[model samples]
Target chain A: MRNVAIIWKKEIDSYFVSPVAYLLLTMFGLIFGFFFWNAVSYFVIIGIESQMRGGGGPMSVNEYVIRPLLSNVSVVGLFFIPMITMRLFAEEKRTGTIELLATSPIRDIEVILGKWLAALTLYGCMLLFTALNFSFLFRYGNPDWKPLAVGYLGLLLQAGGLLAVGTLISTMTRNQIIAGAATFGVCLLLWVLEWVSGYETATWAVVLSYCSVITHFESFAKGVIDSKDLVFYVSLIFLGLFLTSRSMESLRWRA
Target chain B: MITVEGLTKRYARHVAVNNISFSVEKGQIVGFLGPNGAGKTTTMRILTCFLPPTAGKATVAGFDVLEQPMEVKRRIGYLPETPPVYPEMEVAEYLRFVGKLKGLSGANLGHRVDEVSNRCAVADVKHKLIGKLSKGYRQRVGLAQAIIHNPDVLILDEPTAGLDPKQINETRDLIKSLAGDHTIILSTHILPEVEQTCEQVIIISQGRVVATDSVQNLQSGTRGAETIRVEVSGRDGSIEAGAVRQKLEQVAGVSRVVLRESSPQLAVLEVESLKGKVVRGDIARAVVQAGWNLNELHTAAHTLEEIFLQLTGAQPTLEAPASGEKQ
Candidate 1:
């Protein structure tokens, strides 16, 4: 456990010491800020229309403004998660520092968990930027904070799953660009897997949609803490980390 | 402190380390000498637990590298051919992180970090980022990181590969100072490095151990047959190369003579005497009796370079009977 913390600290230091962490934070803030503005303005325009119609129905800010904003945040994560996890293992391998880690007294699991947690932490920081935008709703409106918290929980779990996958892919190659591109490719595929459910009700199609991460995240977005959704995201994290451990084991032999 | 028996690593296409076996006693500095692609790095990698041997076994500090790798890793400090450093990290911060990884903490980690920094002469650059430092400094930082934990065994691969002459001397002194406290095995293709630093030399060639002995033993062991070079000039200001070669060959105990250089004023002949023969006096007398001034008479001892080449079979020496007969 101590070794894991040591690796975690080193990895975090690497991210911040370089321009990568600041660059990622700035890009994510700009893109998500635009999405938040678009969502808020559209919600305001709709609220005005309903007011012009004599307050047709007390519009719920939770449903109208925050839900779509959180969902768009997940989409933005499809791009940012790769950037966060791309260099976790790839850079070490490229710079020959993997030799030090591999030959150290620390176990392989400690190294992998340490690096994965650092990526998750960086992603968590990126998510914090979204909270600043969400704080505006709480200041002015009577939106329920419970569902907002659940939505944030859902975003973290989903990013955890995707970042775990990115961590596994990062171990597969030494080039950070290849790792980033491949992680994006895999994340996009997972995202689009649910499209088949719209056209086909075949059992395979159902299973494919069931495997889609978006399917599991829907309940969290609606403030419903379903056990199955939690199980899905947690299971995805476990599988990704387990495979990463196996990949790391194989490296000792192949290297 | 280290034992490897028939440790072989077979890649998909070729064998990196063939069936090789050697051992190092505690507190002994062994030099792994080989040319490029000679499996020196491969062997060190296996010992460091960075790679497991495909066959056979290795043990370090009584821990099997295959069965109890954690124990083995705990006792070994490795400096790979390329220093495994994170370029963006400050030197002190990187050493602390490595110390933490090596199972040190609290005040002990800090003290060791400071000690190793001073020991490796990297204290001046402790605050500098490793990437911004020069190559020699980076190499020293690498050395410092390896010794930060002060493991029982230190495995250094090409420790002075890219340094200037002064840095190389300092690094050599540091490595020598590290002996008797830590058993170290450093690999290099430089022969004189082995002669100057290592107590034992393991000459490897083509994935095999060609010779393993002390530096002095390997050199003196090849001194069985003596060789002397005699440069002579005629009293009349010119010497005949053929006449000098013929006269030197006739000297007692002189087995063969080859004319090395000839000019209008001098003739240099290399005289190879029979095994364990004292022919220097005979060759000098023969030159003087033939009315030629003996300009130079010196016995050429077999150097480590010749022994290494002879053992590795990289090149046949000029005096080898087989090559001589072929010529």
Candidate 2:
């Protein structure tokens, strides 16, 4: 546990000391802020239209504003998560510091957990930055806080699952660009996998939708915490990290 | 302490380290000498647990490298051919991270960092980023990181490769100072470096161990024949170069005499003595009795360079580099 913390600390320090962390923060903040502005304006326009009609009840802020914004945040992550996780191992390999880590006394699991946790923490920070815009909805209108909390939990689980896959891809090459591109490709595939079920109800389509990361996240986004969804995210995280450990073992054999 | 038996590493097309075996005793400084592509780095990597051997067994500090790698890693410090450094990190920060990674903590880690930086003469650049430092300073930082934890065994590949002469001398002195406390295996192609710092040398060529012995023993054992250089001057050009070479060849115990230089007033010749013979005195007497004024006469001791070339089957006196090129 101490070894994991030590490695985690160094990785976090490296992120902050370089320009990458700041670049990622700035880009994520601006993009998410744009989505936030659009969602609120659209909600306000719809609320006024209903009031002008003088026929319908008040629009739920949770439905019109927070839910859309949260879902949009997940979409933005498709672009940003790759950036955060690309350098986890690729940069170490490129700089030759992987040699030091490989020959150190620490276990391979500790190294993987340490780096993955650091990447997750950075992603958490980006999520927190988006929450700044969401606070406006709670202050101006009455929205249930429980569902908002659930939505954020969903984001965390979803990001954790994707970041694990990103970590595995990072170990495949020493080039950060290649790692980033390959990770985005895989994440996009996972996101769009549910589209196959829209066309038909065949067994292959059902299985494909079951594998989609978005399918598991939708329940959490709707203020529900189903055990099946939770299991899917956790399982993806485990599979990704397990494969990463295996890849690390191969490095010892092929180095 | 280290031991290896039938250690081999084969790449896709070629064998890097063939079935070669050698051992280093506790507190001994051994030199790993080899030409380029001779598998010095490959062998060091295997011992350091950076890579597993394709076929064989090896142990470090009494722990089998293949079986108990974590134990082996805990007891050994390794510096690869290229100094492994993060260019963006400051020297102090980098050393601190490596110290923590090696399981040093609290005041002990801080004290050892200071100690190794001082020992390697990198304290002045501890705050500087590694990428901005000169090659010599980078090499020193690499050395400092390796010794921060002060493991039982230190494996360094081409440690003095890119340093200036002054830094090279300082590194040699520092390594010599570390002899009795740490078992070190350092690899290099420079002959004099081994003579100056290492007590024993394991010379590998063509991915095989050609010879393994102490410096003195290898030298004496390979001194099969002797060469006596004699510089003779004449009184008003009395002796011709051809006549002098002919006469020196006729001397007992002398096998071949080759004239190195011929001038009107002076001549220099190298006389090769027969196997296991001391012919310097014989050549000196022959020159004096022949009425040739002998200005200088000395038998050149066989050098490690010649021994290395002969053992590696390189040209006897190669003008090409022995092993300094990149593999």
Candidate 3:
């Protein structure tokens, strides 16, 4: 556990010391800010229209503003997660520092976890920046905070799953650009797996839709915490991390 | 402190380290001498737990590298051919992180970080980012990181590879000072480094150990016959080089005599004697009887370079033309 913390601290320090962390944070902030502005303005315009009509019920900010904003956060995460996790193992292998980590007393699991956790933490920080934009809703409106919190939890779990996948991909290669591009490709594929559900009801299509991460995140976005959704994200996280450890083990033999 | 038997590492097609075996006693600096791609680094990697041998076993500090790698890693500090350092990290931060990974913490970690930084002469650059430092400083930081935990065995691959002459000497002194507390295996192709710092030399060639012995023993034992250099001049200020070579060749037990250099006034020749023969006295007597002024006469012991070349079967590029056929 202590060794994990040591590696975690070193990895986090490296991320911030380089331009990667800042570039990621700034880009995420700008993109999410744009999405937040469009969502809130469109929600306000719809509220005004309904109020002028004097017939529709009060609009729920949770449904109208927060859900789409949180959903967009996940979409933004598809891009940012790769950036956060790309350099975790790839850079170390390229720079020869993996030799130091491999020869150290720490177990391979510790190093893997430390790096994955650091990526998660950096992603968490990006999510926190979006929280600043969400705070505006609480200050001016009577939106329920519970659903917003659940939405954030769902976003984190989803990001955790994707980051684990990124971590595994990072271990497979020493080139960060290749890792990043491949992670984006895999994430995009996972995101689009649900498209087949709209066209057909075949069992394989159902299974593919079930494997899509958005299917599990839908309940969390609506403030419904399903045990199956939690299990899906947790299992995905476990599978990705387990495969990462396996990849790390094989590296010693292949190196 | 370390032992290996029949250790071998095979890639997909080629063998990196062939069936090789050696051991190191506690508190001794053993020089792993080899040319490039000679499997020195491969052997060290196996011992350091960075890679497993394809066959056989290795133990460090009584811990098997294959069965108990965590225990083995706990006792070994390794510096690869390229120092395993993160360029983004500060020197002190990198050392502290490595110390923590090696199971040092609290005040002890801080103290050791300071000690190793000072010991490696990298204290002045502790706050400098490793990427910004010069190559010499970065190499020192790598050395400092390796010794931060003071493990039982230190495996350094080419510790002084990129340093200038002054830094090389300082690094050598530091390595020498590290003896008796840490058993170190440093691999290099530089023969003089082994002569200066290592107590034992293991010369590997083409994935196999060719010779393992002390520097002096390797120098003296490689050649079966003894050689002596004799320089003489005619008493009358001129000498026949061919006739002098003929006279020295006639001396008892003298197997071969080649004129190394000749001028009208002085002639220098190297005389090789048969095994177990003392031809120096007879050669001196022969020169005096011939009324030639013998200016200089001394035995020339085989250098490490010649022994390495002979053991590795490399062509001796520095051998004189006349003695080239003797090989």
Candidate 4:
């Protein structure tokens, strides 16, 4: 655990020293801020329309604003997660510094976890920026905070899972661009797998839909924390990191 | 100390390191001399636990590299062929990261980092980003990282490969200074470098151990079959260069004679005697008998370069293989 922290700290330092971290932050902030403005303005316009009609009670901000905003942020994250995890192992291999890591006394698990945790922390920072924007809703209206907390937890778990997979992909190649492209492709496939459910009712389609990351995030976005969803995210995270450690072991053999 | 027993590393259809074995005693600097693709780096990688041997065992500091890789890694510091440095990191920060990874912490880490930085002559650029440093400085920083924790063994793969002559000399001096405290295995194709720094050399060829010996012994052993060069001035016009060469080639004990250089006033011939024959006296007597002024006649001791070329090329021709040669 201590060795993991050392690697984690160095990785984080590497991220900030390079322009990639700032580039991802600015890009995520802009995309999420745009989504937030659109979601809030749409919520306010609908609130005004319903109030003028005088038919329904005041609209629930939880449903109208916070929920959709969280889901939209999740979608935006698919694009940024690749950027966060692209350089984790690929850059090390490209620069020949992978030799140092592999030959160090630290365990392969520590290296993988430390790098994955660094990516998750950077992703967490991007989430924090979006959360600051969501804090505006609390000043004027009483939106339930518990759902937002649960929603953020879901975002983190979902990011953790995808980032772990990205870490595995990063270890497969020394080219960061290739790692990024492959991660984006895999994330997109997972995101769109749920669409198969609309056209087919077969067991395969059900399994595909169940495998889609969106299927797991949906319950969390709606203020529900199903143990099934938690298990899915945790299992995916473990599988990804497990594959990364295996890849690291093979790298030593093949080097 | 390090030990290897029939350490072999095969990749698919080709073997990178054959069943080669050798050992290094504590506080000794052994040079791994080989051509570019002769598997020196591969062997070093295996010893450092960066790679595993395909079908053999290697132990470092009494720990098997395969079974106790972490233990071996803890005792050895490896600098690969290219300096493995993160370009985005400052020198001090990069050293700190490597030091921490080696399990040093707190004040000890700081003190060790400072010690290696100063020792490596990289302290002036400690705060400078590594990407902006020159290749010499980067190589020095790489050396600094390797010694930050003061491991028992240091595996340096061509540590002076890309440095200027001045930096190369300085680096050699620093390595020499660390001789008694650290066991170093430096690999290089440059013969003079091994002569300058390494006490013993392990000459590798085609993934096999071809020769190993102390520098002095290797040199003196090759002396038995040394080449002799003779320059003669044939009284300005008493004989043509061809006649001078013909006369010299007739000398007994001379196996092969080649005309090295020829002028109207002078001609130089290099004579190679058969193994175990000293042809110097025979050549001088023959030159004097031929009525040619023997301007110069001296036996040229076989340099490591000739021995290296002969060993690493298609032929393994050393009469007495060094003590480390397995076969």
* lDDT (C-alpha, whole model) for all candidates: 0.89, 0.88, 0.89, 0.89
Q: Is the docking of candidate 2 incorrect, acceptable, medium or high quality?
A: medium
Candidate 4 clashes: the total is 0
Error of 4 at B168 (Å): 1.5
- The lDDT of model 2 is 0.88
lDDT of 2 by residue, B132-205 (tens): 99988998898888888999999999888877788889889988888888999999877888888999999998
DockQ for every prediction shown: 0.80, 0.70, 0.86, 0.71
lDDT of 3: 0.89
| Clashing pairs in model 4, backbone N/Cα/C closer than 3 A | none
Instruction: Give the TM-score of chain B in candidate 3.
Output: 0.86
Model 1 per-residue lDDT tens digits across residues B85-178: 9889899999999999999999999999999999999999899999999988999999999999899999999898877888889999999999
* Candidate 2 chain B weakest ten by summed lDDT: B316-325
Model 4 off-target regions past 4 Å? B223-299, B315-327
Name the weakest run of 10 consecutive residues (lDDT summed) in model 3 chain B: B318-327
* lDDT by residue (tens digit), candidate 4, B1-327: 999889999998799899999999999999999876788989999899888888888999999988998899999888886788988889999999999999999999999999999999999999999999998999999998888889999999888887778989999999899888999999887888988999999999889999988887787576466578888887656547898778777888878888889878888888888877777887888888888898898877677887787767755333331112210
Give the per-residue lDDT digits (tens) of candidate 3, residues A51-111: 9889799899999988988888877788788888888899889888999999998889999
In candidate 1 chain A, what residue range of length 10 has the lowest lDDT sum?
A67-76
Going through the candidates in order, what fraction of the true interface contacts does each contain? 0.96, 0.75, 0.96, 0.98
Which of 2 and 3 is the better model by lDDT? 3
